[model samples]
Target: MASPDLIEQRQYAEAVLGGLNIRPFRVDLTDGLLFVPKSRIAVVRKLCKHFDWPFKVTALTSSS
Candidate 1:
């Protein structure tokens, strides 16, 4: 399981990414909400659970 903060963050992300059909990647915890479609979000989540760290599984995009 991820840390409390990490879990919270992940939950928030899942909620935010709902039905978007996006792909997320791990890029370091401090990196912020920047995801790339190259890895499975579930894999990342499982990894996070295994490593006990927050995972980044959302597509990174720029705001106009």
Candidate 2:
């Protein structure tokens, strides 16, 4: 189950991204991560920069 804080964060993130026409594929509140399509990374990064949000890219592995 998602925690209340996580749900709030997810909604806020969705709203922010939606305004920019960027839809996140997944929101991992527990890990404090947001996953978007590979093609959207550049734009996401730009938005993150504009908002001064920490942006990181992690490669997913078969084991992960």
> By TM-score, who's the top model here?
2
Query: Whose lDDT is greatest here?
Result: 2
lDDT on C-alpha atoms for all candidate structures: 0.51, 0.63
Ten residues in sequence with the least summed lDDT for candidate 1: 19-28
Q: Write the per-residue lDDT of candidate 1 for residues 1-64, one digit (tens) a residue.
A: 4356865766655554444554443344455443655445565456546655445456444530
What does the lDDT read for residue 3 in candidate 1? 57
lDDT of 2 by residue, 1-64 (tens): 7678667756776788888787545556667666777778777767656765443533233333
Q: What is the lDDT of residue 56 in candidate 1?
A: 46
Q: What TM-score would each prediction reach against the true structure?
A: 0.35, 0.56
Q: Which stretches of candidate 1 lie over 4 Å from their true place?
A: 1-34, 60-64
Any runs in candidate 2 off by more than 4 Å, and if so which? 1-9, 54-64
